[model samples]
Target chain A: MYKLELKRLIKSRSTLFLAAAMLGMSVFFACVTVAGAGSMESRGYITLRGMEAIEYQRGLFAEVEGYVTTERLEEMSDYSVWARDTYGRADNMPRDVYERWISYEPILSGSCGRMSCEADEYYAERRAALARLAPSEAAIASALALNWRVDEPFYWEYGFGGSEAGVNWTLCLFALCLFCTVIAVPAFSQGYSCGADGILRCARLGRGKLARAKILAVYSVCGALYLLSAALFCAVILLTFGPDGSSAQLKLGAFVLLDMSMTGVLALCVLSGLITMLASVSFTLWLSSLLPNGVHVLALSAVMLALPSFVNAYMSYPACDWLRLLLPTGSTGLQIGMYNELAAYRFLTLGPAAIWTPFAALAVPALEAPAFALLARRAYVRHEGA
Target chain B: MNIEIQNLTKKFGKKTAVDSVSLTLTPGVWGLIGANGAGKTTLMRMLVGILTPTSGRVLCDGADTREMGEAWRDMLGYLPQSFGYYPEFSVADYLDYMAALKGLEKKAARRKIAELCEILSLTRVYKNKIKKLSGGTQRRVGIAQAMLNDPRVLILDEPTSGLDPGERVRFRNLLSEFARGRIVLISTHIVSDVEYIAAENAVMKAGRIIDAGTTAELLRAVEGRVFTARIPERELERAESAVRVVSLKNEGGGETLVRYVAEGPLLPGSDFAEPRLEDLYLWLFRDERRQDDV
Candidate 1:
């Protein structure tokens, strides 16, 4: 029965069109991000070969690296006096002269001081939640230590500030969820729309086994779409960017300050994306079974998957911010941010174990997928031909 | 197996579609004859367990349909009044899909599907999509799916509605051949389809069975009430308004032969005519319309 349903799904014109549209969107974004990659004029450290060109500047700013420590933050107060004595506050300085001056010791020291100050303020804002998450505090400190790109200069355009590849991945995953919803929401109601539900319900194995078959078919379609889209997106990014810093720490890039390996961070992104896709499809299937009209299911699913993104972007409640990140449409940056240095919030504690914000976020979909599948099955079996 | 409908009733909001009625179906071809909005489809839907009855239950072998939902369906086959099919599916694929729904094994389903297609004269168009088929051919495919499981209790609603004259005759013959031991209830607008083949005939009006018996018995009930008369062309309207005209024929210049159902002669020179199922149908509904008007 599942095989037959899958065949029917793939053969449907609507499903085919949605699948093609999803792939097209993913390819378009990935291509655009790769083609217009990093600029050679930008200042943040990127690749090993790039560091060769700026070795003289790095040696000149060696004194600022020692002052980036947490204990010496007060000693760094003399950097403003030093900047005034060297490059005076002149109105019209040449662009090249200003750029070279900023690459000196005083400017680098001031930038590191500003980063530390911002970290302290963020920690203060989330003190209560941070008190519970000791490991998260440690991870955040480690991420800060590895955050500066003082040596390496290989520009990975896939990072946050480089070419916006991370944002594209997030958008592609979200669009994939929408496409999977379009494919899944009509599985139970196809018969209803065409006047075949009565006949189907009356068939010997239809009322019971057929419901299970439809659920399996929906999940199978969702999984296939995710795998295909994710693989295509990854191939395009990796091939164009040349996987230079994959083994390097995630902090090696200009954005995404984390204490973990680059591979581990990418894995978490993929895991979160797959979980969100599954949860969204299962929840939409349940909605389909509960409602009578296909349009209602589609509309309600749109609201469910989209409303969370809008709320996450606009709403700012520190106490419940971790909970918001647990939503299926939660921000991808937030997932990385949960593991980044200075992520001091710990919204949950299980006995002696401290569940950090990232793990808490992962726990949501881990529990939601099975629960949604069970509810969808129950709704379908109990459904009458209304 | 036997199906007993005990006090079956169904309602759609303020309108009662199938009223409190009871029926016992055994192994034979039972013809259900009714006009539009006569509740034949509603009763059939209830019997098949697709629509829940407002009161009472349908029992198969002493078990309620609601209690034995899947098991009850396992022994039954039904074709709805408005039969639907996936337009993208070919005739063979549609049959195979239905076979899977009915829990038939693959080898058995293939064999059964092949036999049905051949029996229904659909072998040549087996691979053709249903949307591309003609109305008569599509109806044949509907019939093929209904008989896939060789169900013990088979119900078909308006199975001959789209068939041509020759196809209708062929389908009627096929139904007769398939109804040897299984119980088959066919509801249709074509009276002659039931007049010759069905062992028993039932007539419904306003959600209730007004009359039921063999065709000969129903004809006998309205016997001596049917008459034929000759009238002038100009007076034909007056004759029609006075009573029910079952049929009208144009004789030569200005003369007409009118076969009508009436208790007494409407013309000075009239002859008694034999009553058929059509005559009985017109008389029953015509009488009900008159009462509604009053």
Candidate 2:
């Protein structure tokens, strides 16, 4: 029975069309990420984009790729000050001097501009910021304790600017969620619309066994779609950027809270996106069981998928933020999703504990998927047709 | 197998669809005759356990069918008045799918599908999509799916609406042979479909079983009242407005032959005629037809 149900789902024209669209979007977004990449020569002349920019930057930063030690930080600071004093700006220096000296300035300056500070000052400031942001003393201690896992010297390497690919992947995940909605919204409601339920509900196994088969098939198809598209996107980006920066710390500056490597961050983002897809599909199936028309389910599912992004964009209240994080497709948004939350200091305070937003985002949907799936089964089994 | 419908009633809001109906069904072919909206479909849906009744219960061998659950459904086959199939499935695929839902093993399903396809003349279109088939052929496929499990209690609603005369004859023959020891309940307004094969018949009107008995017994209600008369062609319209005309035939030479049902001889030269189930149907639903015409 399960095999037959799976065959029925796979043979549908709409399912096939949406699956093809997902695969096509994966390649298209990967290409967009690569095409938008840009880099400049050490002399600040002869800028390049696309693969040329990637290849040039890879060689320019190769020698300085190990770790950012205190001595290296002081040497970068001394060169930056000398270049500014001699030529008024680092970009105006001679090409050889800028290539060997000023090329590492972006990594040193980062976003906070405090990357070149003394080791003691940097650690003290990070601790103070964490203490101010943490909900309680225990939370502050936990936040500071998390810093011990950071690589001691902080590895530095040319990442081919992989963050561009990461941003595009977030948008790709949003599109995949919509495509999954289209595929799953009709799993049970089509039977009501087309009059198939009249005969189906009379079959010996139609009540429970058939509902289980349909739910399993829908999950299998959606999961496979997410895995395949994600792999394609990752392959295209990794092939173009190479794996040179897999161990580079994501926390490029003192303010960024996460201490994982770039590769680990990417893996977490992909896992969260997959969970968000499953949760959205499960909710859509439950709606399908309750509603009698597929179009209505599709409309409702699409609205729910977009609601989190809209709330995150136009609302600033703390409750609104919690609402955004708790929605089924919460972590697939481009503006305030799992990928961005990992780099920020956002946390959810519960009594005397502070839970990070990234963990809450992943945990909520993991529980929702099974809960909605059970609701869907119950609705289908108890359904009475006209 | 025995199915006793005890005081079955179903209501939608304030309007009652099946009102306090009761019947006991045993092993034989039974016919449920009614006009449109006489609660035949509602009664059949309740019997299948898809629609819950308002104030009654269905018993299978003295056990409540609701408690029986899947066990009750296991011995049943049903074809609704109108049904649809998944657009992607071919005829063979649909039958195979239904067989699996009916809990037939793979080899047994394949064998039964082949046998039913031959019996229903669907071999040539086995691989064709159901939506592409003719209406009559689609109805035949519906019948095939209902019989795949060889159910002990088979219920079919309006099973012969789209069938031509030849196909109807074949269907009647099929049911006659399949109804030897099983309970086959067929609900239809076309009385001839069950006139010859039914061992017992029930007549419904306005959501109630007004009459029920053997065909010979049901026909007795309109036996002496049915008559045939010869009248002038010009008077045919006036005669139709005065009495219930079951049929009319022009004999040429300005004379027409009319077969009608009435209390007594209301024409110049009227003769008694042998009665069939159709005469009783028209006689019983005369007021309904009047309301429909108005």
What digit string (tens of lDDT, one per residue) describes model 1 on residues A67-137? 23333333333443454566576223344444444433232232333233442232232232223334445
Candidate 2 chain A TM-score vs. reference chain A: 0.92
Q: Which number leads on DockQ?
A: 2
Write out the backbone clash pairs for model 2. Answer: none
lDDT of 1 at A242: 36
Q: Which residue runs of candidate 1 sit more than 4 Å off their true CA positions? A: A40-129, A132-163, A240-259, A290-292, A317-361, B287-294
Q: How many clashes (backbone atoms < 3 Å, residues ≥3 apart in a chain or on different chains) does model 1 have?
A: 6
* Per-model TM against the reference: 0.80, 0.94
Q: For each candidate, what is chain B's TM-score?
A: 0.95, 0.97
Summarize candidate 2's per-residue lDDT along B138-164 as a digit string, tens digits: 999999999999999999998998999
Candidate 2 structure quality by residue, lDDT tens digits, A40-129:
654569588888888877777787776666677667767766777888865787887777665666556551244334543544555567
* Residue B7, model 2, lDDT: 91
> How high a TM-score does candidate 2 get?
0.94
